[model samples]
Structure formats: C-alpha cells, structure tokens
Target: MSTIPLLASQLVVTTIFNSIESLGFSNIAGKVFSGEQAEARQEANLKVNTKKFYARGLKSLEQQDLYGAIKNFTATINLNPQFAPAYNDRGLARYKLGYKQSAIEDLTTAIELNPYRAKYYSNRGFMLTRLKDYTAAIADYNSALLLKPNLAQAYFNRGSIRLQMENSLAALADFEAAIRLDRDLAKAYFNRGVTRYKLREVQGAFEDFQKAAGLFKQQGRMDYYQDALAKLRQLCY
Candidate 1:
C-alpha cells in the first residue's frame, strides 16, 4: 500500500517529465512546420507570444506559487486550445493546487487530444489513483504499458493499485517486473519487501528491506533509508 503512494508520485511526473513541449516556439518555428501545421498557428498564441508562459509557470511552481503557476498555465491554455502539452502542464499545476477534479478534466482532454502519447495516460492514471478511482487508474496505466511494454514506471504504478486491493502476489509480480526493467528502483524493492512481509515470506522480506535501504542510501535519500531501516529492525530483522 505504501508502495502504491510512492508509485503514484512517480507516475504523476510523467506529464512534467516532457515539460519542455510547446515551450520554445517562435514565428520562425512555422518555417520548419509547413502546410497545415504552419497555417494552423493561432494569433496571440502563447507558443509564439513568448516562452515565458511555460518557463514562468514552471518557475512559479518551483517557488511554491501554485496559484500563480496555474494562472500562467491558464494563459497558455487560453492561447492554445489544441495544445496537448499546454493542457498537460496546466493539469500538473492544477494538481499541485489541490484542484484534483480540474486537473483530471484537463489531463483527460490532453489524453483525448494526444492519444498516442503514453505520458498523458500515465499522468491521468496518477490523478485517478488520488481520486480513489483505482479501476480507471489501472486502466490508464495499462494503456500506457500497452504502448511501452517495458515501462518500469507503469509496472510500478499498477503494482501499487494491486497492493491497495491487498493482492500482494499480483503486486509482487508487477514490482518484480519493474525491478527487472530497472534494478535501481528503490521504491520497487521496499514495496516488494512490504508485499512479501504481508505474504509471510519473512526471509524474502528481510532481504528486500535491506536492499531497499542500501539503494536509498546510495541515492542520497536518507529519509527513505532511515524509514526502511526502522521497518527492518522492527519487523524483518
């Protein structure tokens, strides 16, 4: 279950990971995108007006000015209704502002506009999980995994939802998939350990917890290491 929360965080960043989209456009940008693409550009468009909307929005988010960031993203969305990235970016800002429902709407529109993009589904799934819509969230994650079969993050997310349902064995399978894809996934290790413990596989739990702590320490995530250590000492050790 704890693993589910961590997976949700990782999946939520899918939208932000490709955050640079629609950030650096200019009138000259049209030169590169000809025909319908060039003629489709909107006047007073945020993409052409300036990169400031995206940059400023990201900056405001980093500064904890969540409302300000949302405003900037709003400007972006108003300027480019068809801009999937703009919608996704706004969704992220909205999510941070605790506008979960609004974020879901924005992200949903984003996915509809850009159905081929895996990140959109991942982002939507992240929010759905928060909304406690586990079924929809897993469906979205599955959509992403369908496009990118080896996507460790998607596996991690699905594993989390399974964990929430107390399906530890299924959760463990997904965690193992994630680890096999990326051995450095500390979250997967910790989560798999928790799942193993719940399944009464004590020795396996101990090994996983120990490895998770070591991996967290290697990544300079001391809080994670400390937490894992406490759990290991109290339960696994």
Candidate 2:
C-alpha cells in the first residue's frame, strides 16, 4: 500500500468499545420474562461478546497484526453491525493492509453510524487524501474542524493538503492554527516554513525553519532535524 502521512499518532481504537454496555439488544425471551429483563439479559450477553472480540482486535493491532485485527473486528461487527467504533477500527486495519477502498467504505459506514465523531471525519479525510481525492478530503477536514475547532491534527492535515494544491496562503493559515493549538508540532513549523518560502517571505521562513530544527532535535527526530537544517542552510546562506 502507498504510505500516507499520518494525521496524528495512530488513533487509539479502545474508545470505540467504551459504551458497549449501553446497546440494548432485541428481547427474544418475550413472555417467559418481562420485556425489560429479557432485553437487559440480551444486552449483557452482547456486551460481553463484543467486548471480548474488540479487546482481541485491539491487542492484535498493538502487535501490528493487521489481519488478526481485521478478523476480530469483523467478528465484533457481525455481532453488532451498528457498532461505529468496530467499523472505524476495522477501517484502520484495512488501510494498514492496503485495502484502501475497503477502508474508505468502512469509515463511511462508521460516519453514517456516528456523524458526531470528529475523528471519523478526520480519519476518512486522511484516507481520501491517500486516494488523491483532494476536494473530498478537504470537505471532510472542514467537517472535522467544524465539529472540533481545537483539533490540531485536522488543521495540520488540512494544511498539508492545501500545500499539495499550491494554496500557499491557506496552507500557511492552517499551519499557523495547528501551531497555535499545539506549539510543539514540529512538522507544522516545517511546513509553515515551506509555505512561507513559497510566498517569498524569506525572513519568516528562516525563523520557522530554525524553530522546526530546534524542536525536531528536542523530540529526537534526527531525520526531520537534518531536513530543517538543510532548508535553513539553503535559504539563509
């Protein structure tokens, strides 16, 4: 699969299963037990099974066992097709396994199941960028930001896509927002420097590049630090 830039560190999937106990199952035990009691029992059983499979999937993902994670997530989905988190996690696993189209489908389903989740939109946006669907990706990023204005990753990712489109001013705006939200985001500074260079803002670009190099060094990202230093040397000297 083509490697795509991650918007953030791999988003933890555990949050998806956090509300399993609340999903009420259909009561099949009608007359023998009260409807409420039957439903409660069914829900409890479903929660146990779903949690078990979800936990297994999470462990597999942690081990980098993409196939194992997919299989377990699929089992969890089969038990509860409405489970948005399962679809989100399975989508992530599918993306890792190079099933980009399938991953998008799963993420779309997850969005349909839970439109309020900013992460779902952000995840789908990242996948769309991988497919080179820049317009759709930007729209998804917009939605994510609308839902969560404080999301630094969304700003950074959107800035990256803007940079690819040669929208230097917009890209700079996004990178600035990301930096405001998280001053420690080295890549945002680096990209901002690149955007400033594109706009011929030499002094600003130089300052950003220097800041990026210092932050990358502090974060132990030697490769990024080297790249920043190279840019500084090329521009300043």
Best by lDDT: 2
134-216, model 2: which lDDT tens digit per residue? 99999999999999999999999999999999999999999999999999999999999999999999999999999999999
Q: In model 2, where do residues sit more than 4 Å from their true spots?
A: 1-36
Q: Model 2 residue 174 lDDT?
A: 100
> RMSDs, each prediction?
21.9, 20.1
Model 1: lDDT of residue 146 = 88
Q: Give me the runs in candidate 1 sitting further than 4 Å from their true place.
A: 1-47, 50-52, 235-237
